[model samples]
Target: MAENPAYPVGLRLTGRKVVVLGGGQVAQRRLPALIAAGADILLVSPEATPSVEAMADAGEITWHRRPYAEGDLADAWYALIATGDTEANTRASAEAERHRVWCVRSDDADAATAWTPATGHSEGVTVAVLTTEARGRDPRHTAAIRDAVVEGLRDGTLVAPHHRTRTPGVALVGGGPGDPDLITVRGRRLLAEADVVIADRLGPRDLLAELPPHVEVIDAAKIPYGRFMAQEAINNALIEHAKQGKSVVRLKGGDPYVFGRGMEELNALAEAGIPCTVVPGISSSISVPGAAGIPVTHRGVAHEFTVVSGHVAPDDERSLVDWASLAKLTGTLVILMGVDKIGKIAETLVAHGKPADTPVALVQEGTTAAQRRVDATLATVGETVRTQEVKPPAVIVIGEVVGVGPRTSA
Candidate 1:
């Protein structure tokens, strides 16, 4: 294999013939991108998704309702085969190669001489994410990755047609813990100039409001202890947006480097031949407690603190938390999402020798205008949770340090 040339400019597929084989969802998905890239599309599929039907109704491309034929590859600039059968995709790939056309084999990238990178587009720029191992595990995974990139592009977090030369690109900006004002000055400045703002739900709406109306915004919000977007999707979105030469801001709650999955995105961008930078922000771990007038560390009461998530895997496996070690320590312990599992968490701490009456405070909606705080001992915290009906987006602090709250009420 040889090194692929850095995106060939004038060679873009404007007014070019592009043949897509397969009548399923993948073929349907590939059409719009090729169309937007100015390819004259011919979709060969026996069936199509509702989205495809809608596109065909709009007359965006020509549809041939049938299986692949030897003549399908004639006079085409590129081909994308997305069928259920690996054998069919392989056959289409071989024919395209024989005719010297670029092909993307939806099932097996190895079958094609070239592969499509996860891509993102903006005003004038087009960004793509290519892997050295294009023929690995599954092409669906590759397409799925590209889909996320497209979502960000559509929402405005990643822009394109950056300078012919590289410039400062993706910046991981912290959105602060649900309070737009708490965001750093640097974070706000970057967001204002951002071509795209890829944000998560934890990033407050107030912060999003800071961006001008025209600046693009994408919501990548993942609910804690519930359904979430896949990591690959998010990573690919970042790379694609940057490729378009737009200043992309990945707005995350708290600091991107801190437990924010920032490393995963950073690694993915580096692997795809794009460069990225990171910015830090205040974390909810300490800020939430402070908002409730509970100092994480005090001169006489607490010399240390610990922050842990109550995330448990789907298989009902044990948590990675060394509760025994944490239980014996003499520091403040802040647990995010420990509300539902407060009973279990309390049991583990007590069993590990932490006193049952250790002071614990549950801070709900911390840092927002509607913040609430409930103070209790470790033994009663779970029961108190049940009685008070405390919901998530809450933080739990357990230690003697919690007893030393400010005299005023939270």
Candidate 2:
């Protein structure tokens, strides 16, 4: 038996070969991360879910329209056997060993060479929560902590602690995904109470429609894809608003702490002797795709999921994404920038090991009235987008979950 290697922090697969021997939802769950990490994928199974077929057609992965066999793993580097049948997985594992490949048998976690973890990624940060012999999470407490964060978003109390006593309140809220309706009730109420609202260009505008006409609305005058108001200037504005006792709300999309830069703003307030609270909003990273009819988790598709940002800084050579390692994982990949870098991202995924034909969906303004979807594979996605025009404020989803959306004509 080969010893399991230690997992590195901030892992992603940029280039690698990973074979998933199953066609059901579970196997589908493993495709996204592998594609995101840049792994070439070969899916082997006699039967495949609609999602799997989509991936195959998109060229995100190569499909073997046959059952698992001893010869399938002839050149496999890392293998995942996720079929419902334990016997099949075991047989596949034996075949992988014969070819000197490391294997992870999903049916038997301990028997596999590696274990997948529940992950939350934002900005360039990734947090992996694992429950293993060496490290574990408290299921009971975990839910409570997660809820508290959600509650903060549901109510402006978390983002604007001083609002409780002041005449007007100030809240830095995250709106979550692209759906205007998904904003927490508290965030909604706070938006109503705002005498003045300073929103990011990306924040969904529909959510702001409910505001009173008398309440002044400012765009905060940010430059598109460019720096507008410096953080220092923005912090000063919040403090300025609070000193006047005007209810001020700083709105952001998705959970603020996750990558919305909520902490920096909060710190600025604190240093200025102003009190602030943070409310967590539903992260679009998971919710947008979910509302698009995709489940980040399914019985067989995946046991764990990871979230990452599509936008990386130009100068940062150190990618928070460990593409080589992520290529070996099994999870859904949700990217925030669906159009800007879809082609490069698809190419990177394919070069790594993800099948060039992996299924990919570009959901523009997901959960909104103007929502549009383009279904294609990693190989054809670039070409497909060229033929079809997709605007910004979109989410790019690649995985079995995408199969849940309306069918795309080949």
Clashes per candidate, residues 3 or more apart or on different chains? 11, 45
Q: Estimated TM-score per prediction?
A: 0.56, 0.55
lDDT of 2 by residue, 1-410 (tens): 33444464443445566788988977777777777777788898888999889989999999988878778787667788888888888888777777877776767765665665554433233445544342333545544654555554444334433335546546888877767778878677677667778787767687677666777776755513234456666777778877787778888877887767788888887787766656578887777666667677677776766666667621238557655554455667777754766777777776678777666777777776776777888788877777887778777777766675554321
Clashes of 1: 11
Candidate 2 TM-score versus the reference: 0.55
Model 1, residue 332: C-alpha shift (Å): 1.0
Per-residue error for 17 in candidate 1, Å, reads 68
Number of the top-ranking candidate, with lDDT as the measure: 1
Stretch of 10 with least lDDT, candidate 2 = 154-163
Model 1: residues with Cα > 4 Å off, grouped in runs: 1-168, 222-229, 313-318, 407-410
What's the lDDT of the predicted structure labeled candidate 1?
A: 0.77
Per-residue CA lDDT of model 1 for 1-410, tens digit only, reads 34454242234788989888886778666778877878888888788888887777888888888888778999998888898877777788889988998877776655566666666654344666665564344556656777677655544344333345547479888777777778876677677668888887777677676567777898774413234357777776777788888778899987786668898888888898877878788998988888788899999888999888776521237778788888888888999866888877887788889999898888888889878898888788878989999888788888887777673335
